[model samples]
Target: MLSTKEHADVFRELLRKGDRLYLVPVPGHSSALPEQLAAIAKNISADLELVETYADVFAALEVAVEGEKKRAIVLCGSLYLIGHFLSSINN
Candidate 1:
């Protein structure tokens, strides 16, 4: 899952073994950086791989999909991020 700090905890709840949780920064907004979010998640003993902070969702997805098997990706958080993803695909 990819999310910002506002919904990080909720997204963390949906984590499963083998899942990767990606926390990203919300540009222009005062929120926890992705690194900080990862730290917080680790503090709580969140399972799964906590990859490094990615500033771009597409970049994150690219890395996430690099394996052999098919995968399911969930993009959650602000509507702006969702819209950004949608716009990116439509381009």
Candidate 2:
């Protein structure tokens, strides 16, 4: 899991590259509000996609990669989603 500062740093770097970023809010956590997240994206000039479920993240990444040929997926929200994806990839 990444610390808040690490996450922020990664987000900053990703934004500079203009990459499409998806943020899946962790269930039961509300510190990262949608509007705030969107505003952050807008501030950094990067596209932001909100994902409400783990499945949504997978589907979105698959569609973006297969349909749009995007090669990287930067998930910036929800440690649960991050663990899920990491476990899947490791397995």
Candidate 3:
């Protein structure tokens, strides 16, 4: 999810151990930087990866999928981030 660290902290209970989390920065917006979000994930001992672009996200997703096992991918946080993701995919 592309959100602030504070927001994640409040909803941190939703995170479980061993979850693979990829943190991406939302440039020029009021969101948690990747490093900031990574701190929270590290606190819970979650597997975390920081990526710079949507390309990196897709690359990570490709590696994350094991065989034919379907995995749920969630893209959340602010409407701005959602818009950014949608715009990226459309292009």
Candidate 4:
């Protein structure tokens, strides 16, 4: 539901506070953006994790939700990823 800028701002703020971020990558696609994000986080001294599967996504969300302090942001690469997440959530 958040715009990309809003998500980026949240990410920046989280990075500022030394929070861990997980960037879940869409399979079989270009990983340029995720890689760039990882590099940016590294530049700002933030921890970044790249996960690439449905199980990974579920696990990351479960951990973040259970942790209650940290947050996890899922960046869907294309319409396909967005649709998948949307459908899953709706169902």
State the lDDT at 44 in candidate 1: 55
Cα shift from native, residue 37, model 1 (Å)? 1.0
Candidate number with the higher TM-score (1 or 2)? 1
Which window of 10 residues has the lowest lDDT sum in candidate 2?
46-55
Cα displacement (angstroms), candidate 4, residue 6, comes to 16
Candidate 2: clashing residue pairs, number = 0
Overall local distance difference test of candidate 2: 0.52
In candidate 1 the C-alpha lDDT for residue 49 amounts to 66
lDDT of 3 by residue, 1-91 (tens): 4454465564376556545666565645766666666666677654433222333345545655646366566655556766776787899
Candidate 3 whole-model C-alpha lDDT, 0 to 1: 0.56
RMSD of each: 3.2, 4.9, 4.1, 6.2
Among these predictions, the greatest lDDT belongs to 1
Worst 10 residues of 4 by lDDT: 47-56
Residue 20 of model 3, lDDT score: 61
lDDT, each prediction: 0.65, 0.52, 0.56, 0.50
TM-score quality measure for candidate 3: 0.61
For model 3, what is the alpha-carbon lDDT of residue 80? 73
Residue 33's lDDT within candidate 2 is 48
For residues 47-78, write the lDDT of model 1, one tens digit per residue. Answer: 66655679878887787778837677778656
Looking at model 3, residue 81 earns an lDDT score of: 61
How many collisions between residues are there in candidate 3?
A: 0
Off by over 4 Å in 3: 1-5, 8-11, 45-68
The TM-score obtained by model 2 is: 0.51
In TM-score terms, candidate 1 sits at 0.71
